[model samples]
Target: MSEFVRLDPHVIDEIVAICDTTLDELRSARRITDFLAIGHNFGDFESSKQLAAGYARKGAGTPESARERVEQFIEALTQLRDAFASGGEAFLDAQFDWTRQLQNIDIDA
Candidate 1:
C-alpha cells in the first residue's frame, strides 16, 4: 500500500488549478498541505470506504489498485472537499483525465 500512499504535491496543485478554485475555499476544506492530514490517518476500513463513496459522488475518480487504493481514495476526497467548499462540483469531469494518465509516467528514480 505504501507504493502510492502519498498525494503527489504536483497533483494537489493540478487539482486546485484544473478545478479552478479560490484559495479560501481550498484552505477551508482543511488547509491541507500534507499527505498525513485527511486520508492517510483515516485509520479503518469503514471510515475509508465512506470516504471513497463520497469522492465517487463528486467529480473525483477511483483508482484501479486495491492495495494502494487508499491513496487514490483520499486524494479524491480532498478534491471533493475543496470543490464542495467553493461550489457544487464546478469543474467538469474532464478535469481529472490527467489523473488517469498518471500511471503511465516514468517514475523510476
Candidate 2:
C-alpha cells in the first residue's frame, strides 16, 4: 500500500512567493550583463584588441554567452514559480475532494 503525502498549501504559497522574488532579483541583475560588451578594437595593440574581443565574446557576444546563461536561470525560476502555483491549486482541489468524501460517509452504518 502506498501512503499519500500531504502538502501544506501555505508552504506551497511561500515557495511560490520566494521563487517570484528571486526571479525578480535575477531579472534585475541580468541587466548588468548588457554592459559587458567591449569594443573589438579596444586599444592600439593587437593583443589588446584580441583580449577585448575574447572578453566580449564570452560575456555577451554570442547566443551561448554569459548573458544567455543568466537568461536561462531566469527562465528556470519562472517555470518553478508556475509549477508551484499549479501544484498548490491541485492540492487544494484534492483536499476539497477528500473532505467531501469524508462528509458523505455514514460512520454509524
Candidate 3:
C-alpha cells in the first residue's frame, strides 16, 4: 500500500492526463514508464493488474507492459479523485467495491 499523502488537484490532473494519453503518445521515443511515475506509489497494485489484464484481453494496440502501467496510472488517479471527493476514510471504505457500483450504474438515465 502507498502512503496516505493527498496530492494537489493540479497534480492529479497531470497524472490523469498521462493516463488518458495513448501508448504511442506516452512513449514519444521514450519509455511509457517515464510518464507513469506519479502512480507508482498509489497502491492498489492488484486492481491495477486486473485492469491491465482486461486491457490486454481487448487486444488494444498497446503492449502489455504499457497497458499495465497505464492502467495503474488511471486507477490510482481515480482513487485519488475519490479520496478528494469524499473523506479519505470513506473513500478507503468503498474503494474495492467501487468498480462494481460503477458498472451497475445507469448513466443514461
Candidate 4:
C-alpha cells in the first residue's frame, strides 16, 4: 500500500515567513563581520603588528573566518526557504490533479 502525506498550507506559510525574518536578521549580522577586519599597522611595534594580524585571522581575513561562516549560513537558509515555497506549490498542484482525476471517474463504465 502507498502512504499518503498531508501538509497544511498555513503552516508552510508560517515557516516561510519565519525563514524570511531570520534571513534578514542574518544578513544584518553578516554586515557586522566586515568591521572585524583589522588593518595592519606599519608604524607600530612588532608585537602590535602580530596582534593585529592575529585578530584579522580570527575575524575576516581567513577563509574559515566568522564572516565566511555567516555567508554560508545565509546561503543555506535561502535554499531552505526556496525549497519550502516550491514544495508548497507542488503540493497544491498535486491536490488539484487528484481532485480532477477523482471527478472524472465513470463508475458505470
* Estimated TM-score for each candidate: 0.24, 0.61, 0.27, 0.63
Tell me the TM-score of model 3.
Answer: 0.27
For model 3, the superposed segments whose C-alpha errors exceed 4 Å read 1-63, 94-109
What TM-score does model 4 achieve against the real structure? 0.63
In the range 1-96, model 2's lDDT, one tens digit per residue, is 233444577977898889888988887777877666756447879888788777777677566677766676676556556655775444444544
Q: Rank the candidates by lDDT, best first.
A: 4, 2, 3, 1
| Clash list (residue pairs), candidate 1 | none
Clashing pairs in 4: none
Query: Candidate 4, 52: how far from true, in Å?
Result: 1.7
Write model 3 residue lDDT over 4-49, tens digit each, in one string: 5455667656654554464335345234444443443445799876
Regions of candidate 2 where Cα sits further than 4 Å from its true position: 1-6, 40-42, 89-109
> Which stretches in model 4 have alpha-carbon errors above 4 Å?
1-6, 40-43, 88-109
Off by over 4 Å in 1: 1-67, 93-109
Give Cα-based local distance difference scores for all models: 0.43, 0.65, 0.49, 0.66
Q: What C-alpha lDDT, on a 0 to 100 scale, does residue 3 get in candidate 4? A: 33
lDDT of 2 at 14: 91
Q: Model 3 clash pairs?
A: none
| lDDT for model 2 | 0.65
Candidate 4 lDDT over residue span 1-109, tens digit each = 1334445878778888998999999899888877656555433888878777766776675556777666766766676666566645444445454455444443332
- lDDT of prediction 3: 0.49
- Give candidate 2's TM-score: 0.61
